[model samples]
Target: MGLSSRPRCQLAEQYGPVFTVHLGGQKTVVLTGYQAVREALVGTGQRLADRPPIPIFQLIQGGRGIFFSSGPRWRAARQHAVRTLHGLGVGRAPVADKVLQELRCLVGQLDQFGGRPFPLALLGWAPANITFTLLFGRRFDYQDPLFRSLLGLIDDVMVLLGTPGLQLFNLYPRLGALLRLHRPVLRKIEEVRAILRALLEARPAPAPGGGPVHSYADALRQHGQGGDPDGLFSEENVVACVLDMVMAGTETTAATLQWAVLLMGRHPGVQDRVQEELDRVLGPGRPPRPEDQQALPYTNAVLHEVHRSITLLPHAPRCTAGSTRLGGYLLPEGTPVLPLLSSVLLDKTQWETPGQFNPGHFLDADGRFVQREAFLPFSAGRRVCPGARLAQTELFLLFAGLLQSFRLQPPPGLGPAGLRTVPAPAFTMRPPAQVLCAVPRPRGR
Candidate 1:
């Protein structure tokens, strides 16, 4: 938490980008700065592609799902998920329609407040529902008991997974497990699995009209039944895979959306520019499309800035697939490496203003969008986020649509300066809890 404002990059000044940390019983390497992280993750290439065995994730996934799994299982499951998610319209225009639909639903929810304060958690619903639509082939009602339960369980899991107890367990598995430190989150995970099991069983015989909804579950069923190879598609494995997609697809995207709302509220000048661009290009009530990004460079840059500045996953752990040398350091096979992505995103050499919320980081002199090499929020190389395009599409539409429909602001007795932007404790870097007013806009169409 102390590192929130200080940033881990400053540590590089004292220890260089490639330094070692001795955590109780484990000795791991920390890769700071853009050059060092890139050299380790990209330069070493496939040899650094494996996920280190973090005890917490091992308990949750058991090396079965795509997000935390390694070796052939990770490779094959990733291949299958990419093909299936693409076929389900993840990176294509068809999914944009569904995202826009959720935006309308979200707008309606915000309209309920009528310029009153609303909880920050509500912002997660739209993005999370979009993820559910992919996993179960349907979206859930915001008020549904099952939907509410699932979200609550996910909340518990995320917090628990980031708790000190979990970290202690990771460093000393046997001693921590003896004290039952892992049970709380593990119990919550089981509850989630129960819900997933019911959803799998209750699936419609066919996919409504498209034949299996998005049919991700159905695809897994068929894949498991065939060849009888490694049992990667077994019923338990299917549950884990679906669990990975739901958790991965929901939390970070929703967190980013929350940041968008909070940051726009905090910086009204930036919000005004975003609103002007949306109003001029998209017009009132038109809803944003993926293609609209080309014409909405300012809005695009703000959204990108939100991501770059936040540094959601500060340092994702990667294990060496085999022994490899990086930055003149020789690492043994299976060594755990902590690559500081936050440093890369905020590299002094990369951004003109590393600490400020400057959309110009992604803009040229003429204000056209420009991709920077250090803008690696999704990381890179063999272990890059497979759903990167899907996430980008959701973020652009949801963010643009929100700005089009309303002006986000802090509630009564609060001003923009009072709005808290501190990093909250979670598996991912979450924005602090806040209640803000989403005042509706006049269409003037």
Candidate 2:
């Protein structure tokens, strides 16, 4: 929740890759850089993949959801979610189509400003709607009050969870409860739960052929039928699982794209390079397709650079399972772990320009898109983000579509040097509130 240049970086410099830190009297192991984090998380993921219990999250999710929950329940819910998303065409054309549909709406919405200053606040709704379509088999209109309220609640929870007060609450649950410090977050969680409950109730049951309508909810209903008398697919877990996916997917992606647009608008030279690639690979009047990503390497590189530069999650939360030795230290069982992804992204040894927005980190000399091992935005190991592919596809298509349709510009008299890119402190690091103009590209070169 601190600024992007995590204080942990200084700690790593002083204490080496794996050092012990005391947070609220809890002894936790911090893993920094690419090598140490990969070795601990990927090499020994089984022993280090568990989640430490946070009092606030324990109260909010009750350890029922896939995220923040470990052991059999987390395993079952995660497996089912992956299988169900694949069954519903998450990694394929259907999801791409849904993303493109939403992108068009977003582009159209941007056009209404007519080159005037527009804040990218509502930009999150587009990706949120994609999750809505995937989970409940429906999309919310941009102007829908219910949709706005739902997003607002999600925003409130994200912001509240990252506050220092929440940390104090987690440290002393009884005292914080007496003080009502976590009441706002608790209220927001309940509101979201209620919304999920209503959506689940209204969802149509699975058909004989197991059709796509209400695919996720239907699959959860079916999966719950054959499990143990009480299992992860219970009505409660269903809502929690959906909430996990929605919360996990929506804001991170929306923030990523928001940064994408901000960086592009700020860096017009890079934006021009991306537009050149888009125009060369995709002819005039042609809609950008997912397949075009390979041909438009610079565009893809820009997106990857944005992911790296933004440093979305400073550190991913993880914990140890059994006693294990890592980084030449014997970590006791249940040791909390914070794999500093920000450290990895900005590792001086890994990237030539860690702080700057340079797409070359992901591009080869031949100008082709290349993936670096140090790039762990979705994290690594067995607990890596399950929706990585889905997120990538949506990001590429939406980014290309936007660049194809519009030439992003900063506000009048504000150039790249004047544009501020540092993100505000939150659950997810998001670009600061700012205005930009999405000037439409003129017809044909």
Worst 10 residues of 1 by lDDT: 1-10
Please provide, for model 1 over 365-385, each residue's C-alpha lDDT reduced to its tens digit, 9 standing for 90 to 100: 998999888989999988889
Error of 1 at 66 (Å): 0.7
Kindly report which residue pairs in candidate 2 clash with one another: none
Per-residue lDDT of 210 in model 1: 35
Model 2, TM vs. native: 0.96
TM-score for each candidate, following the candidate numbering: 0.96, 0.96
lDDT of each: 0.86, 0.84
**Model 1 residue 365 lDDT?**
94
Error of 2 at 258 (Å): 0.2
Q: lDDT (0-100) at residue 413 of candidate 1?
A: 91
Q: List the residue pairs that clash in candidate 1.
A: 207-212, 207-213
**Best candidate according to lDDT:** 1
lDDT of 2 at 140: 87
Model 2: number of clashes? 0
- Model 1 lDDT at residue 424: 84
